[model samples]
Target: MDKLALTFELSYYLWGLLTLTIPIAIHLLSKHRGKLVPFAHIALIKVKNSPQLNQARLTQWLLLILRLLMLLVACAILAQLVWSKNADTSANLVLVSNDWLAQSSDAEKQQLFEDLNSSQNSRLFIIDGLNQSLSQRKLESKALLAFQGDTSSTTTPPLNIWANLAEISKTLPKAQKIQLYTTNRLNQFTGQKVAITNPIEWHIKSLPNTLPETKLTASLTIVSDANYQQQLLYVRGALDALATTLPLDLNIEYLDSSLVQEDLDLSQQQSHIIYLADAPLPTELVNSATSIISSEQLQGYTQADFPLTLATKLFAAQTKQWFADNARLSNQQITELPNLDLVNQQQTNTGNAQSLHLWLILILVILFMTERLLSEWPNKHSRQVEGN
Candidate 1:
């Protein structure tokens, strides 16, 4: 198999390269101005040694080169030039979910391995509870045996390992085809949708399992806007009693008017929510709600341009303990593998800019020291005696 390779790409502030002309222009414009004295014979002095003229010309050229190098180095530092090592684009990534090969004959397994080896860039990984690369497992026979002997069954909830799809997505070094091998068990799926920015062509082999559907518990959260202080208190009184009566975990939130318009962030582990607010919610917030109460009992409009509204009932029938008892058994997080949506909302970039800066600094110092040594070497020789 061909080794995993990276291509080198360089990026810098392009305008900095144009500054190279500055040093060359100075070298061309500056000429030695000679103080000439009146003389009877311009030819009296022996013709200046040809060797000395050649040596002086050589010195000027060397000095020009050194000065230009110094300027270029400084510009590079300011431009923050960086080199990026990118993974091979043409390489194929094949994730062999063990379930795909579980029931296949030995001949099929051999054929699959042969097909993979045919492509120089094909890399295979096995995914179940963990993603293990075939390269690391060296012994193909042992790896296949291990896959067949997988004891982490989805039938038992406590023994089952819930593979976090969001976390799995982050482990991917680059965008590639994703394959999942598993039995169709409800416990394996996440409570919420997983949103991945990468465009992965998913190939799944979900073998039907004998396990019954895993029952999930539910949570109820209530949020009220600041303008409705009296309303918030009334809702809390009703729900707080329901929490004790039905033994339900009730989370209550009161947001100020300034903070009310902000979108509420949700996670797979979190409960479905009920929001009571007067202001119009953002598109995302409206879509996330299980239920919303935008107003109360009374409603009226003045004959003029004035608007008036009132509510006769502070707590409705839906806000009672009976509704919460039924809500606890709702199937909010159950789904099959393909349409499963488990979201990992945290985003972090992997680049280390500080490390790059340190490397550039080290190179710049080395170039400065080299230039200094070369500049003073010619003078040191000039100071020595001719016949020493």
Candidate 2:
């Protein structure tokens, strides 16, 4: 059996339905009354009922009904009624975290695939750290192979599983079951716990102690002249400290004259360049390097804290990449879950609303034309009878 759900976009417009009483009041108040005629004798006059009288009475009732229907349809249009059929309850929606797929062994992957394939109505969705939006795909062998590659390069913050579930549940039909397949790594759960409106069967795979690591390498060049020799020492010290802690390589260069073609070539090879001179960097070098920091940036820092400040700035720039390489999985354990009743239930699909609007507009037009014709029909018939 198909279940029907009705929703209103502008619910306040439903107040217009109160106007339907106006036509009914007019119908009762404007009832046709016979006029008084002066006569010499009561027996001299014979009362004869006109055939058009019955037609007029019938038309009056029809017009009232038509007017009431027109008002109702108009109110429905303003309210923007949305009609949707609930999806099949037997169908299953499976959400798989990309982090789990990246760390899971081949045997585990095969077992998961077999379990989902056994359920013919199951649909698959992959949730990755990079993209928060859900992308639906078929549960096939080839599709599973595509997700096997290293996702660490594109990793952002830890995946917020509860938040994603809260958002995705809004679009799904009520009573439709959802199954979530993810790892039990605590680092992967970063955000605050959200209310789970939909009941989700959790398939948490325990992660191993050691996960795969991603290594990052970059070339850094520091160019300084005699004028900024003192500042250069602090910058080099900062670079040395950064090299030990971060996966970075420093290629220090000191130039007294303007950068030549060879200097530009070296700059091209380096990923980032720090220019600690008064003169502006050459347009060629600026365009060749991925990022360039000028001496003007060192204005606020005192000489005493210059090395620490410089190191902090450099680390901040590469924080995202550092997290990607080092923090692949967290060691924390999940102790308790959030309250499910707090999940937000009010969810709407834009596509369904738009399609419903188009349909209602068509019905409104047809009702309007029919009411106009019915309103004029009684008058036209009365005139024909009087002429004859």
Candidate 3:
């Protein structure tokens, strides 16, 4: 657990001591003052009328002691002083998180889950929407359900991460350490305690060499599904990643909107056409195009030519295979391919084990044990002195 200090916590024990001691001292000292009574044989009266000996004073002292004990208990809990000897010693390894991102290819997600599966004594917290649960399994054999539906940012804001971390700390024994496996998205979170030991950042960069305008090309086509009337489709490719945004003359395309936002449903055979005025065909697209139609007939396509091979490779890839094999097909086959710069890359690294941190936690447990014993020793000595 991350330690945070409350300003007035230390003062509670001091207050308790002062409250009890001041009253006791006053009562003891007051006895030294001599007093006179009008009645004869007042010694019996003096014994009965002693000021400190009362049920109310005893109750007050008991309350002060109880308050002090309560404060110490609270402090111990806040400090996570309780350590479980039987807790899994292998490594606390609380799954910081496992999630999917659009930036990652379908293959990357599969490999990532595999890596998580391989970690021994590790818990899995799959972040689909919130976080899904899975029984621990072998890394190689673990099967993860592919993330489907919209790949856009989550609708609601992510769960309170700090609160999640706090809860995780409580669930595990104080002896065990913690680790996080969050995506780059969580890098925004700063100043976290619980010792983030090793965080691996994933970066996927696509290197695209500009194809000469002379390299053969074809028209940019947008495909949609039967249900696409409710959704918007935007044709995004490598050019968007390189520069600010895709550079296409929307005037050539006589469509409702040139800007596509939602995922394009190529499941059904619906296709949107773009017309170009003076743009030459991209090498990838023209080579893949079965029939090249007249240029004047096209109205809404971009004047800037895109590669034909890039389009064919992208459309033929798993993105298209997923739709063809899984998604329901329609009668109309999409012929005009969108400008696509498909990137297929993987990065795998083995993490180094950290055992020194475990030793540090052990030292802390010993310190807490020693402190508890020492605190009780003083009380025992005080009682012995009183008995003597």
Candidate 4:
């Protein structure tokens, strides 16, 4: 049997719904202050002892509705209200990958598709290495009918879908359970193993199969000035330690003290360069390097042609000055790959509901402007009539 329910992504934001009363208060205040004030005509006009409810005309209904809609939308956005077929934590959200489907029989694939398509209680999503939930909108349109899953590509790219179910779940409204139908690839699970507090219930489609693998390989170069040799050794040792943990082909090179950033070999396939200096690195090293030298940092906002980053501190046990730099370097290098982000991810609601809020706020602003115009229409009409 199919189940249906509506849920809020951020139930906490429902508290903002209390603000709806503000518009009502404003409407009442405006009416109370609409009391007639006369000077020359005061002698002819009689002041009523008791104000009647009918005395306050109700012509601003459109304006009131517009203002009310703005508040309602704001509250809806804050609440992140979404309609879920099943709101249970146990509700199954199945993320299917291409590799898993490839190993299955045609009959089995058809059955899986029919079952998911028939069930209103579960959602079927398509996933691959480079994309997650390829046809989210398309799936919704089809009434969420599951097939073996859609073809995500012309060629099945090598996949390392490590904890991909957990990532997709984070983006979805919090549910009781999630499952990934995939083959076990070691690359999918290469990140540091920590017990997931809210782990995805992994459902293996078949025994693990080996996919074509890619290694993180980079050549490193260091300034060979005698003054920085000791620090350079620390950097080398740290790089080697990082290299051992993954499939990395590392090559080392040296730069003379007189060598400038322009002296760097631009044609080399090395992905990164390290500049060890007492001062900041020159910008030209980024140009001569085939590898992008920039990282996601904000020291200097200069946009370089290649990925460049100002060299960060590399701490060794021998140096008591800064030991945490080792951890930073390790983390930065791993992020150049996948799966590591999950191990380091701080547990929070994974869905980005900000876009929801943004769209609602935009509508609310438009409604506010319309409401203002509506409220002034009567005044404008009155002025024109008096002038005629």
Candidate 2 residues lying further than 4 Å off, grouped into runs, are: 1-54, 71-75, 114-121, 128-136, 141-147, 150-167, 174-177, 183-218, 240-248, 258-262, 299-308, 312-319, 328-369
- Our tally of clashes for model 3 stands at 18
Instruction: State candidate 3's TM-score.
Output: 0.28
Better of 1 and 3 by TM-score: 1
lDDT of 2 by residue, 176-280 (tens): 678888776655677677665567787786744443254344566677777888877777776676667655544555555365434667665766677777777
Residue 271 local lDDT, model 1: 45
How do the candidates rank by lDDT, highest first? 2, 4, 1, 3
Tell me the alpha-carbon RMSD of every candidate: 15.4, 5.9, 19.0, 15.4
Residue 251 in candidate 3, Cα distance off native in Å: 25
Tens-digit lDDT string for candidate 3 (44-78): 76456434346445544554444444444444443
For lDDT, the strongest prediction is: 2
Q: What ranking emerges by TM-score with the best candidate at the front?
A: 2, 1, 4, 3
| Model 2 lDDT on a 0 to 1 scale | 0.67
lDDT of 3 at 274: 35
Candidate 4 backbone clash number: 8
Model 1, residue 131: what's the lDDT?
48
Q: What is the C-alpha lDDT of each candidate?
A: 0.47, 0.67, 0.36, 0.52
Span of 10 residues, lowest total lDDT, candidate 2: 327-336
